[model samples]
Target: MSGILRFLLSGLAVLLTSYLLNGVHVRDYWYALLVAAVLSLANVIVRPVLIFFTIPITFITLGLFLLVINALIILLVDFLVPGFNVDGFWWALAFSLILAIFNSLFDDITGEKAKRNQD
Candidate 1:
Protein backbone atom coordinates (compact mmCIF):
# COMPACT_ATOMS: atom_id res chain seq x y z
CA MET A 1 0.00 0.00 0.00
CA SER A 2 0.98 3.60 -0.49
CA GLY A 3 0.67 4.11 3.21
CA ILE A 4 3.48 1.65 3.86
CA LEU A 5 5.67 3.37 1.32
CA ARG A 6 4.91 6.69 2.94
CA PHE A 7 5.85 5.27 6.29
CA LEU A 8 9.17 4.06 4.92
CA LEU A 9 9.77 7.41 3.33
CA SER A 10 9.04 9.14 6.58
CA GLY A 11 11.54 6.84 8.24
CA LEU A 12 14.08 7.76 5.65
CA ALA A 13 13.36 11.38 6.35
CA VAL A 14 13.95 10.81 10.02
CA LEU A 15 17.23 9.07 9.31
CA LEU A 16 18.30 11.85 7.05
CA THR A 17 17.31 14.44 9.59
CA SER A 18 19.28 12.61 12.23
CA TYR A 19 22.38 12.73 10.10
CA LEU A 20 22.00 16.35 9.16
CA LEU A 21 20.85 17.81 12.44
CA ASN A 22 21.46 15.48 15.36
CA GLY A 23 24.14 12.86 15.77
CA VAL A 24 21.87 9.84 15.58
CA HIS A 25 23.75 6.71 16.50
CA VAL A 26 21.82 4.51 14.15
CA ARG A 27 23.59 1.23 13.59
CA ASP A 28 21.64 0.35 10.48
CA TYR A 29 18.68 1.21 8.34
CA TRP A 30 16.49 -0.96 10.52
CA TYR A 31 17.26 1.24 13.49
CA ALA A 32 15.99 4.27 11.69
CA LEU A 33 12.90 2.36 10.65
CA LEU A 34 12.21 1.40 14.22
CA VAL A 35 12.67 4.95 15.42
CA ALA A 36 10.32 6.18 12.72
CA ALA A 37 7.65 3.71 13.76
CA VAL A 38 7.90 4.68 17.41
CA LEU A 39 7.95 8.38 16.58
CA SER A 40 4.81 8.09 14.50
CA LEU A 41 3.01 6.19 17.21
CA ALA A 42 4.00 8.74 19.83
CA ASN A 43 2.92 11.60 17.65
CA VAL A 44 -0.48 10.09 17.12
CA ILE A 45 -1.11 9.00 20.70
CA VAL A 46 0.67 11.57 22.84
CA ARG A 47 1.11 14.79 20.92
CA PRO A 48 -2.50 15.93 21.08
CA VAL A 49 -2.52 15.72 24.84
CA LEU A 50 0.69 17.72 25.05
CA ILE A 51 -0.61 20.33 22.64
CA PHE A 52 -3.78 20.68 24.67
CA PHE A 53 -1.81 21.21 27.86
CA THR A 54 0.51 23.76 26.27
CA ILE A 55 -2.23 25.77 24.60
CA PRO A 56 -2.06 28.77 26.91
CA ILE A 57 1.69 29.11 26.64
CA THR A 58 1.54 28.46 22.93
CA PHE A 59 -0.98 31.25 22.56
CA ILE A 60 1.05 33.54 24.75
CA THR A 61 4.09 32.99 22.62
CA LEU A 62 2.11 33.52 19.45
CA GLY A 63 2.75 29.97 18.24
CA LEU A 64 6.56 30.05 18.41
CA PHE A 65 6.20 27.67 21.33
CA LEU A 66 5.56 24.98 18.77
CA LEU A 67 9.33 24.68 18.72
CA VAL A 68 9.18 23.47 22.29
CA ILE A 69 6.46 21.07 21.29
CA ASN A 70 8.77 19.73 18.60
CA ALA A 71 11.57 19.31 21.11
CA LEU A 72 9.23 17.44 23.42
CA ILE A 73 8.24 15.16 20.57
CA ILE A 74 11.88 14.37 19.95
CA LEU A 75 12.44 13.73 23.64
CA LEU A 76 9.40 11.50 23.74
CA VAL A 77 10.72 9.47 20.81
CA ASP A 78 14.08 9.08 22.49
CA PHE A 79 12.39 7.98 25.69
CA LEU A 80 10.09 5.43 24.05
CA VAL A 81 12.75 3.59 22.08
CA PRO A 82 16.40 3.06 21.41
CA GLY A 83 18.51 3.90 18.31
CA PHE A 84 17.13 7.44 18.16
CA ASN A 85 19.09 9.78 20.31
CA VAL A 86 19.24 13.55 20.07
CA ASP A 87 21.74 15.21 22.33
CA GLY A 88 19.76 18.11 23.74
CA PHE A 89 17.05 20.67 23.19
CA TRP A 90 18.99 22.38 20.40
CA TRP A 91 19.50 19.12 18.54
CA ALA A 92 15.85 18.31 19.01
CA LEU A 93 14.90 21.69 17.59
CA ALA A 94 17.16 21.10 14.61
CA PHE A 95 15.68 17.64 14.14
CA SER A 96 12.22 19.14 14.10
CA LEU A 97 13.19 21.65 11.42
CA ILE A 98 14.74 18.99 9.21
CA LEU A 99 11.81 16.66 9.67
CA ALA A 100 9.33 19.36 8.69
CA ILE A 101 11.36 20.29 5.61
CA PHE A 102 11.73 16.70 4.46
CA ASN A 103 8.08 15.80 5.03
CA SER A 104 6.89 18.87 3.17
CA LEU A 105 9.07 17.99 0.22
CA PHE A 106 7.92 14.38 0.27
CA ASP A 107 4.28 15.35 0.36
CA ASP A 108 4.73 17.82 -2.45
CA ILE A 109 6.37 15.25 -4.67
CA THR A 110 3.85 12.54 -3.83
CA GLY A 111 0.76 14.75 -4.02
CA GLU A 112 -0.18 13.60 -0.58
CA LYS A 113 -2.88 16.22 -0.16
CA ALA A 114 -4.87 18.73 -2.08
CA LYS A 115 -3.59 22.26 -2.44
CA ARG A 116 -5.49 24.87 -0.53
CA ASN A 117 -8.22 26.37 -2.67
CA GLN A 118 -7.59 30.01 -2.00
CA ASP A 119 -10.68 31.52 -3.54
Candidate 2:
Protein backbone atom coordinates (compact mmCIF):
# COMPACT_ATOMS: atom_id res chain seq x y z
CA MET A 1 0.00 0.00 0.00
CA SER A 2 1.01 3.59 -0.41
CA GLY A 3 2.52 5.53 2.47
CA ILE A 4 -0.57 7.70 2.75
CA LEU A 5 -2.78 4.66 2.92
CA ARG A 6 -0.56 3.04 5.47
CA PHE A 7 -0.61 6.21 7.54
CA LEU A 8 -4.37 6.47 7.44
CA LEU A 9 -4.81 2.84 8.34
CA SER A 10 -2.34 3.11 11.16
CA GLY A 11 -4.32 6.05 12.47
CA LEU A 12 -7.41 3.92 12.43
CA ALA A 13 -5.56 1.26 14.34
CA VAL A 14 -4.58 3.81 16.94
CA LEU A 15 -8.12 5.01 17.29
CA LEU A 16 -9.41 1.50 17.72
CA THR A 17 -6.67 0.55 20.09
CA SER A 18 -7.20 3.71 22.12
CA TYR A 19 -10.83 2.81 22.49
CA LEU A 20 -9.91 -0.68 23.59
CA LEU A 21 -7.32 0.41 26.10
CA ASN A 22 -7.86 3.07 28.75
CA GLY A 23 -4.67 4.82 27.76
CA VAL A 24 -5.93 7.71 25.66
CA HIS A 25 -9.00 9.77 25.14
CA VAL A 26 -9.28 11.06 21.58
CA ARG A 27 -11.59 13.94 20.90
CA ASP A 28 -12.26 12.50 17.48
CA TYR A 29 -10.63 10.62 14.60
CA TRP A 30 -8.66 13.69 13.59
CA TYR A 31 -7.07 13.66 17.01
CA ALA A 32 -6.36 9.99 16.55
CA LEU A 33 -4.70 10.79 13.24
CA LEU A 34 -2.55 13.36 14.93
CA VAL A 35 -1.63 10.87 17.63
CA ALA A 36 -0.77 8.24 15.04
CA ALA A 37 1.45 10.59 13.06
CA VAL A 38 3.37 11.49 16.17
CA LEU A 39 3.61 7.84 17.10
CA SER A 40 4.96 6.89 13.67
CA LEU A 41 7.56 9.61 13.79
CA ALA A 42 8.52 8.63 17.31
CA ASN A 43 8.82 4.99 16.32
CA VAL A 44 11.00 5.86 13.37
CA ILE A 45 13.26 8.22 15.27
CA VAL A 46 13.06 7.32 18.94
CA ARG A 47 12.72 3.55 18.77
CA PRO A 48 16.00 2.96 16.93
CA VAL A 49 18.04 4.84 19.50
CA LEU A 50 16.23 3.05 22.28
CA ILE A 51 16.81 -0.36 20.71
CA PHE A 52 20.48 0.38 20.19
CA PHE A 53 21.01 1.62 23.73
CA THR A 54 19.09 -1.28 25.28
CA ILE A 55 20.66 -4.05 23.26
CA PRO A 56 22.41 -5.42 26.33
CA ILE A 57 19.19 -5.67 28.28
CA THR A 58 17.43 -7.16 25.30
CA PHE A 59 20.11 -9.79 24.92
CA ILE A 60 20.09 -10.56 28.60
CA THR A 61 16.33 -10.94 28.61
CA LEU A 62 16.35 -12.97 25.41
CA GLY A 63 14.42 -10.15 23.71
CA LEU A 64 11.56 -10.21 26.18
CA PHE A 65 12.81 -6.92 27.56
CA LEU A 66 11.46 -5.27 24.43
CA LEU A 67 8.16 -5.11 26.22
CA VAL A 68 9.62 -2.61 28.65
CA ILE A 69 10.93 -0.51 25.81
CA ASN A 70 7.55 -0.60 24.15
CA ALA A 71 5.94 0.47 27.39
CA LEU A 72 8.31 3.37 27.72
CA ILE A 73 7.52 4.47 24.20
CA ILE A 74 3.83 4.29 24.94
CA LEU A 75 4.33 6.31 28.07
CA LEU A 76 6.34 8.82 26.11
CA VAL A 77 3.50 9.21 23.67
CA ASP A 78 1.05 9.72 26.48
CA PHE A 79 3.25 12.41 27.94
CA LEU A 80 3.82 14.15 24.63
CA VAL A 81 0.20 14.15 23.52
CA PRO A 82 -2.29 16.10 25.55
CA GLY A 83 -5.59 14.36 26.35
CA PHE A 84 -3.91 11.00 25.81
CA ASN A 85 -3.63 9.66 29.28
CA VAL A 86 -1.82 6.52 30.32
CA ASP A 87 -2.90 5.37 33.74
CA GLY A 88 0.30 3.75 34.93
CA PHE A 89 3.54 2.11 33.87
CA TRP A 90 1.83 -1.25 33.82
CA TRP A 91 -0.97 0.19 31.74
CA ALA A 92 1.55 1.49 29.25
CA LEU A 93 3.13 -1.93 29.08
CA ALA A 94 -0.15 -3.69 28.49
CA PHE A 95 -1.39 -1.07 26.03
CA SER A 96 1.76 -1.14 23.93
CA LEU A 97 1.76 -4.92 23.70
CA ILE A 98 -1.81 -4.92 22.51
CA LEU A 99 -1.14 -2.07 20.09
CA ALA A 100 1.91 -3.86 18.70
CA ILE A 101 0.02 -7.07 18.11
CA PHE A 102 -2.97 -5.31 16.58
CA ASN A 103 -0.88 -3.05 14.36
CA SER A 104 1.15 -6.00 13.13
CA LEU A 105 -2.04 -7.71 12.12
CA PHE A 106 -3.32 -4.49 10.53
CA ASP A 107 -0.15 -4.06 8.52
CA ASP A 108 -0.14 -7.66 7.42
CA ILE A 109 -3.63 -7.37 6.02
CA THR A 110 -2.89 -4.05 4.37
CA GLY A 111 -0.21 -5.29 1.92
CA GLU A 112 2.70 -5.01 4.33
CA LYS A 113 3.07 -8.77 4.37
CA ALA A 114 3.29 -8.91 0.61
CA LYS A 115 5.82 -6.11 0.48
CA ARG A 116 8.01 -7.73 3.10
CA ASN A 117 7.70 -11.18 1.57
CA GLN A 118 8.66 -9.76 -1.81
CA ASP A 119 11.62 -7.98 -0.35
Best by TM-score: 1
Instruction: Kindly report which residue stretches of model 2 are placed more than 4 angstroms away from their true locations once superposed.
Output: none
Candidate 1: how many backbone clashes? 0
lDDT of 2 by residue, 1-119 (tens): 37888778877877787788765566678877877888888889999999999999999999998888878887888888885777888888877777778779887888787887898
Residue 10 local lDDT, model 2: 73
- lDDT for model 2: 0.81
lDDT of 1 by residue, 19-110 (tens): 77635555567888887788788788888888899999999999999889878888888877676677887888888788889988887887
lDDT of each: 0.80, 0.81
Output the TM-score of candidate 2. Answer: 0.87
Give the Å shift of residue 81 in candidate 1.
Answer: 1.7
**TM-score of each candidate?**
0.88, 0.87
